[model samples]
Target: MSDEGRLIAGRYRLIERIGRGGMGTVWRAEDEALGREIALKRLHAQQHLSEDELATVHERTRREARSAARIAHPNVVVVHDVLDDEGLPCIVMEYVHGTTLGALLKGGGALPPGEAARVGLGMVAALRAAHAAGVLHRDVKPGNVLLGGNGRVVLTDFGIAMATGTSTLTKTGEIIGSIDYIAPERMRGHKPGPTADLWALGATLFQSVEGRPPFRRATAMETAYAIAVDPLAPMKQAGPLEPLIEMLLAKDPDERPSAEETERALRVVASEAPGATMGTATGGTTEVAWASAVPSRATATVAATGPTTSAGATLTDSGSGSVPPTPISGGGSGSAGDGTGRPRRKRRRLLWSAAAVTLAAAAVAGGLYAVTADDGGHGRKGSGTATAPTASEPSPVPAGFRLVREKTLGVTFPVPDGWKRDGRASAEQVTYTDPSGLVGLTIGTVNPAGANPESHFQNIEANTKLNYSTYRKLRMQRTTFQGKPAAVWEFTFQGQVRAFRAIDFGFGEEGGTEYDIYLSAPEAQWDTHRPVFDTVKAGFRVG
Candidate 1:
């Protein structure tokens, strides 16, 4: 019978069925009391299951609501209330106006690398929030991801999520997840952890950019085998995301990059995405890409032989009732080693030199410029003399520019009219970011200046190189600023999704206060944005 127009809990009146998955049916409903629309999920009835099994399902439904409730993040869907109606559990969720990433991919072949990175950033943000709350989103496939019309990429459906310290709902030796997205370790019956979710995210990203899952076979059993034993299918269009995806899909969880590193990498890529902006309300047919309900498939269940050692044979069950041990192969493309005997962890560093070369070529072709302090209109390269008015003596703000005086940092500088102060500013430093969030200008102070500014920058560069796989130095040299010992350091590094160029000018006397003026922007647009740095430098003043 149709449940249309039915009132549940004497409050929610069902409007229409929006989605149906294995576990439940979601309805667009009106909360008459609250006067707002909500999504209500009614647990699917399994009449054939025993009483005990039914109770387990009920408990899992409750846990799903609880698991999602624990996390309060913008990227995660909001769970409002849980109600018991006619002995079945119904969950009320914030109705999102958008479509699933799966639906978008199905309708549109594949997203461009930059656009895919933009979506990946939202997904990673949701995952990070979940992990921080000790929750594991075991089922993180594209179908469960909601793209809201307001430009919010949300991760929904915590139906199979497992919070830390929670007991397993499924029986021993049984795996519950989409076969194609299952992590290799999970396929081997190892205890799934945060890395397992990351593995699924990698697979999701692969599909987003490549238009198909990494592993797809004729049958579920064969797909399982591919995930656990087969080499990763070669990628054709992953672009900058290829290396990160390869590392995330490594069979060994230890080989995967941490969530923090993944976010940084994704941000770098998303920064370069054309027309990439979150939280903007879109309309018309384009709204379909942001929000709409898509059918959710039930997670498949497969029986495994038993837990095996990391080096032991993997056991999988074929639907024909045969259980066989799949011997672990050595040095496949999917293995932790990148086919060259070098561990995948070290491969990211190799990208640094190559990216550096590309950035250098682009800069040269684009006529890269540098920030220079005015010196009687003599355009000597890397001029460090300060001619701008001091903080005590303010000068006229140039057209299309605004002078910002920061008392905490004891400095004043001119920034583009549209740039706004970043919330990350603190007592130590102040930063203003462009509207696009890609470029930034920062003014900071060092209480005790170092013996030499150049040496201090070199020390900092050493650490930056270690953390950033694509860090490349253009120059680090000693100079004079306002008759004070100073240094100018310039370099380029790959952000989570794109390349960026940065320059820093530090000037001060030994044992006295040091001032730092820094600017960074997209390497591709460096030529056009480079003059902003020059403006800031020309107008920079210290007390």
Candidate 2:
């Protein structure tokens, strides 16, 4: 039997070798401490290095372990313990049961749009969190993405990710991560920053959807050429994804859409996702962090185009580049500008849907025809202008189809593809259900401006029409969402547990502030669908 198969560090009994990478060996092990499974990554202790050299290597490993432990993100692999056995270091991490994106791609080709969007969104969200904590994931390629049990997507192997604000343990100007995914500027010996990771994400997203990277070369020089000199080839099978692929693969790091933009854009396709968040029962990561709060040109579009898109609007970051707070044009001007991903002043005060109505209002309220009374200006009695009152039309619904609507206490949304939306309009609530009766898509909207999410939850419990008493008993609790402060509520209803997960923001919905909340189904399906709320939750943006 090989030494690799032997157990190490006493309690972690190695069952078998699952994988081998350049830096470590991963073994399926029993964590007797918790009596659950874990991935034990041990440095090649048997390698031919001197005792002092071994000590130095393990010292670096320990530093990485400490760095990784502080991440505390769902997308990044969770590191449970670092053990020293026989003077060598071993890291115990959460064991992921699903295949890596690399393995998935090796067996086949590009992923479909929804799956691709899901993966891309997960990766971007992970990078955003990491960057906020001042860490740069130098090695952010597909091989490092781990699909965990419970369909959780995690970015792994933070061994090379380093803190950005200071020159810590890592060597100065020492390039790390994969060579193939390195940004062109970094390849030329420039200091790597958040932008570098964005470039890598573009490369990774391209490969995930097109079956090949944006650049491929037999030699390092040719690889650099592909990234530096040549224009990226249009991804063959990527359709509407053309926009995302273009943004992710943009040559200028600054031009790439922020991680938030990528995630928001993905929601259009992911909204109809039938299963788990990604629905594949696993996850992966491979993107970089955006620079700051302002919207970048890559993600922001001028409103010369129509206001409504099947995809949702981008939310600006709250940091350095945030858009200035000011009102623009008649309520929402004809266009919205983006700064560091925030909604420009013009896009404020209305979710994109209201913009449609506003446009029509603009057309109807023009000039003397405004003189018409409450009956509408169309052929007003004795008014000088009877010119077939110009009407601004909303986009056409498909033939033989009528749009349905749904809502909860304070929130409402349109059902696009016949999930049979049914709910109240003016009362500020909505609900949706497909034929199968699995999902209880209930929503509550509130313009709780002066109140925080906590007080607002209390308000929701008191006013909701169904199970108000039981819901009040659940009581809202605060918890971490990805990296944001979030509120959650768990309750029992009719022999099943129901959980609501939400993050609060002052949204411009229907000319008011809204809580923009989401609730998972009863317990029978909670485990199956709760993750979907996160996907939908990310789509909620405030201008």
Candidate 3:
């Protein structure tokens, strides 16, 4: 029978179906007593399930309510009640009149860096609250994030949440959650901590700015493999939010930054985003337009084979190959059928096992390669004798500036008279700072220049975006310097206490030495200090 207009428990009436997913159906319902709209999720009927399986599903539904109700935060969706109707469990929650992050991204494309940082701030806050309550939202994805019309960004859907002391409610050899967002440790069968959720947050942020998951691949198995061992795919548009995202996606959970650090980083970016307004933990202002969209409440579950071990196992989806479930065991044989009772596919036992082995091998190989690699005679800064400039004779030093030669890089540039070289100067680069330490100039080189200087700058900018918050690009373009191919990149980024602007000029031929001259100063003093870069560039010479 159609569930529309059906009243369960004689108090709440289901008015319309708002969304459906693999595990349940969500309804837009009216709380007759309170005269307010509420969202109700009812477990799907599974007549074919054995009594044990049915009971497990029922318990999971109740647990979801309990897990979410434990956290009382504005960024977390409110769970009003859980009830029984027609032998099924139904959860009543606040009816958010907004679109999901996933739907918004799908329809409108990726968000700007600042906007994404705002969204991330909300998510991390919710996560902090959940963790404080001893709740682990194992499934953190874009689909589960809601942006309310009232300028609130909320995290929803605790279907797979694991409360600290509660039983897993999962079958042996079963791993439940979104495949792409699952942490690598979880995929390897190790227990998850708060960092697991942080990893998912990273993937969500990556999608928010780049329009795709960092390690996404064609099939579930391939995606799992990539997440387990592949190098992070290059990012093109993450801007200032890239660094935190990369940190969150670290393969080792311990290596990921703590929630407090993550939130602080996100706040820095959000504060500087255009049209951004800070929001309190209770409820805050957002710049995004919310749509009337709701995501389905289904959680993807994959079954695996072998005894669960600390190392983890491989996983296989029931029938749909779209988003495969993560593995839970190292090896064994099992058959998973599409819920249809048709023939099941034999489990691939060696999938994750092989991936783990390959990962270890690659790591070792990479270490060995780094140790054996040759670095051309550009030894440590003080280890070698200085080489004189080769391109041209010294030009007259401008007033208030002095000619400085970097022996290691065989380059000369004009430095403001009061600047001093920093102690951390190395063979590859040297940095000099003005008396206030708010301004700096660095001269560096690349042994084998890339195909072009502009592309090289772009590559460096990608990493810079990850490292610096509130990083804003002014210009990156190709030009000529002394008749050699060169590029200039300019941008501003947030420093410890203030914002700083920077400009870099690099030039050389492919496979030859490339020289880089960079300058940075406090944004407020940029205009006053800008002329220093011009004077230095005019006098810069390379051998």
TM-score of each: 0.54, 0.49, 0.54
Candidate 1 vs candidate 3: the TM-score winner is 1
Prediction 2 TM-score vs. true: 0.49
Q: On a 0 to 1 TM-score scale, where does candidate 1 land against the true structure?
A: 0.54
Could you give the candidate ranking by TM-score, starting with the highest? 1, 3, 2
Candidate 2 residues lying further than 4 Å off, grouped into runs, are 45-59, 165-173, 272-543
Among these predictions, the greatest lDDT belongs to 1
Give the CA lDDT, 0 to 100, for residue 72 in model 1. 93
Report the error of model 3 at residue 512, Å.
43
Tens-digit per-residue lDDT, 299-398, candidate 1: 1111112111111111222222212111111111222343356654454334322332322121100000111111222353344234644545664467
lDDT of the structure predicted as candidate 1 = 0.64
- The residue ranges of model 3 lying beyond 4 angstroms of the native Cα positions read 279-543
Model 1, total clashes = 15
TM-score of 3: 0.54
**RMSD per model, one decimal:** 24.0, 24.6, 22.1
Span of 10 residues, lowest total lDDT, candidate 1: 363-372
Prediction 3 global C-alpha lDDT: 0.63
Q: Check candidate 3 and list the clashing pairs.
A: 188-311, 188-312, 189-312, 243-466, 313-329, 314-327, 315-327
Over the stretch 182-248, how does candidate 2's per-residue lDDT look in tens digits?
A: 7745533345677677778777777888887676644333344334323456567665455566655
The whole-model lDDT of each prediction reads 0.64, 0.47, 0.63
Q: In candidate 2, how many Å is residue 260 off?
A: 1.5
